[model samples]
Target: MKCFVAVLIIVTLATDAVSEASVRTCEPIKVAMCKNIGYNQTGMPNLARHTLQADADVTLQTFSPLVQYGCSSQLDLFLCTVYVPMCTDKVALPIGPCRGLCESVYERCYPVLSEFGFQWPAELDCSLFPAENNHEHMCMEGPGERTAPVGTVTLDSVNAGGRSACRRLIKPNSWVWVRGSSRCAQFCEAEVLWESGERRAAEVWLATWAALSFACTLAAVGAQLACGDRGSAGERALVLVALCRCAAAAGWGVRAAAGRTAAGCAKDSTTPTRMLLAHDGLANPNCAVVFLLLYYFGLAASVWWVVVAGAWRASVLRPSVTTSGTGTRNDRHSSLLQLAAWGVPAALAAAVLVTRDVDADELTGTCFVGNQSSKSLLALVIVPEAICLLLGTVFLATGLRAILRRPVPVPAPTALLTSPPQQITDQTLLRLGAFAALYAVPSTCILATWVYEYAWREDWLAAPVPTEIPSTQPRPAFWVFLFRIFASQILGVMVAVWIATPRLKALWRKIAGPRKPPLTKCPAGPPPTPLTLHCYATHSHSLSRSQMHKYATYRPPQQHSYRKPRHYHYSAGETIL
Candidate 1:
């Protein structure tokens, strides 16, 4: 019995030793391929008992045809040929078949090897296989290979011959794989259709908002113009602002319309490219130029006009300042404002044209500076506008503080009694407050969006496939989209509402037509007294005697005495005598 026990122990030890040796001797590529398919190395001992070399040799021989068609290595050939065909049964192509085959191969090979006193290894690395190599070519390996069904469609087919359809369908960073040419084609078509619809929707949204903004700005400008020179300096500055907003809105609308028909440049579907150069070739450079120039000019002018308006209000609100030299000061200030509003933008646009390329992009949905040229835009346009907005905000805050801090006159009691109390209206301050708040909305939105884009610069420039399709995007992306849309498209309308005033409304009424004033009649009164003859003669130094005599016949009414008689004392004295 002791000898039998000792023999059993020796036999078990030998089996373990043999399993370890066999596993160690297995080719690294075969082990990797097996693991890549799905065989865990923990069960590799079972696989080790199956003569791994012989099995790999046979698998290679069976799929040798794939190597001739540019398969990168033996593992690549095996994945494309032996594993994919065996597990799929030639039905629909399996998703990530190489991975599926790995799992399937391990399951089938494990049980057979376990019968021989071996188990699969647990520590083998399977990720070394070049799964990214084009697998579509392997589909043509055998003589009776299947083809896509008739009436099936494919996308990006123009460059389909160069790269694997599977690789194209599954992005490099992504790991999910779809199966079958028909299904893959359908998936791709769905994505394409969704992207096209999103683009069209974005265009329509931008155009519609832009048109509304343009109309509102026009109304604001008309109201200001109708006021003529009677309007306040701040109101006049607002006219320029409205004009700028109108131009900006019109430019955005034009951009949206032009982008639909403009096919700038064809992108290389195979190789990765920079976002700026990827779409720089403009078919309609003229339209691009118009939109970009107008957009920058209008944007800059709008901000500066706000500054001008704020400054005007600040000056008007100062107590020590008189209205005597206001006309002269306004003339000078207006000239400077005109120069800054129009000239600064022109110079910036010209600089951009000279030093950088202008291009349209999905971000703005309009022609503007290109991605590589974005720094210039930041320096010339964005930075200046931000600074102006900041300064405008400060001025507005100061103006508001001044308005709030202004002392309200306490009427003296006697003064109130002697004169009617005058009504005091803080209309100017209220208007200023409204303008400040309205201007801040778009400016703040713009600044916030800029920060968001800068922080996520890689996400923006990565140019992800079907980038505009919102369904697959994360939550933050949607917020960014909303921010951009609201900031860029609603400024004019908000400004219009901000500047709408009673004076503006009255001006509009006058432009519509004047109304007639109601007629006022005098009230009836007592008749005048006739002159007396005696009085006329006494004062008639220039009157003739005949005229006096003619008037003397007129009699005057007699006067009656109201006093009592004083005869009591005299009557008493007479009676005593």
Candidate 2:
């Protein structure tokens, strides 16, 4: 019995010693403002998350202006407890403010940060601290924390997190910090980070518009098909362009329709609390599918746009062997056009896949390359997009110049006009202009929006950190996202408009209106046997003697009757299916 008690006593003493010695670097609070508040000893890596005492003092010093402004009476204790957490023999883990205390201070002080174009610092995330002082999760629940009078700070209608913070604040099912980023930024998997209906509405809008775009592209392709080979070289190339648009719109439509599911979102390799898309191409199966459709097909559509413009320029500059289709040059360019439209995007997509540039865009909930990475955005999107526009623009401008320079053929004044049919009406010119604008305008706008996003990406990745000057917090514009969704799909609808011309309508009617009954050849047969009739002289009652004798064997004078010829037809041996 005595031995058993002695061993038990020794074990208890050992546990107490370990607990007491847990804080090795306990020392006096070096921060000036924090010294006057209750607790004296502090541990390293203060709650402001400064590692060194000197650094902690400096960061806390920056907040002196707000402390002086008196947002909260408890602000001093709150700041010190976090920046210089309580360290003592009584407690092993440093004692930081309770979640309630942290939230209270946050509510008061975030407004001040807002004024200076800042967000609530991630270091002081209230959720990171303990809920209450307890054995397992100990924290400093300040005396009468609930009973303490609240501060005079105004909590405005604006969320204290500000737009950038609010935009990024996702309630993720699972998350990891975006790889290579220092801030607590997460790549969410499975949902969009929307705080209000406005954001949700954007997603719905994209899906609906994309569906419309798909329908429009189908209409354009349908019209082209119905017109058969009658459309010009430019219009023919437009058929291919419309087909590409159909594919891209379908991809985007898939993304919008999926709506906050695993298919559209991706994982960030780095923060647990936050989820952002990491650059891992084809890592998610749905992401891979979307990438091919939007990137490969979208790029293909742009290349085809270049082909459309180039065909127009060729018609004006090279004229044609005949106006029926185009010059021989067009036939020669067909192989090159196919290579450009398909092969180039395929190569680019292969590169993006190997490099894993695919990322899920937050605003649209669509997996695409360059949504979260600036490098990917610049290389994969901005550069290629700009180059496509540049080429198309050059072709369009050259073609316009050619058309304008063509000589006008004034009718001769004698004007009996040895007339041949012509179709150079003002309406035709207007349709051409509208077609060119529709093609170029949406493309240019999309590129411009991409440039803005590329510029805004770095700031977006590192939120709550004020990189910009205090005067402006240039948050990534919500309109940029909305515009991107609209412009990306509007090209397809515009193509439909271009195809809705009177010319195509007439051609459609001619091809699909009514097939005429085909003419057939007359049958080859022996000539009609001569109709043999021996004419006997009419009874000579009224005839003279000589006339009666001469006419005796002469046929009843050949009597002719006028009537339409009987037509005969022979089948060509074609079997209708």
Which candidate has the top score in TM-score? Answer: 2
For model 1, how does the per-residue alpha-carbon lDDT over 1-577 read when each residue is reduced to its tens digit?
9999999999998797566554442123343334454322222222213334345445444323222222122234334333322222232221222433344344433442353345644421234222332544122121222233422223212221211322343232211112211111121112221256565666666778888988888887776666664455666666667678778887776666565334222222221121111123243564455546465656665666566557655664764555566656777787777777777777777776664355444433455653323444467656766877787777777777776787876768776664432222245545655776677777777767765654554333232366465544222364465556667667778777655565577776777788779898856695444432213122324546685455446545447733222122222112321
Clashes within 3 Å, all models in order: 18, 11
lDDT of each: 0.49, 0.67
Candidate 1 lands at a TM-score of 0.50
- Which residue runs of candidate 1 sit more than 4 Å off their true CA positions? 1-194, 263-283, 363-365, 370-377, 412-425, 460-476, 498-504, 507-577
Model 2, stretches more than 4 Å misplaced?
1-175, 178-185, 189-196, 267-278, 412-421, 424-430, 464-472, 501-504, 507-577
Clashes of 1: 18
lDDT of 1 at 385: 66
lDDT of 2 by residue, 349-459 (tens): 999888766766655557787775666788888898899899989988887887789887777765454343234423443455447656899889899888887665554
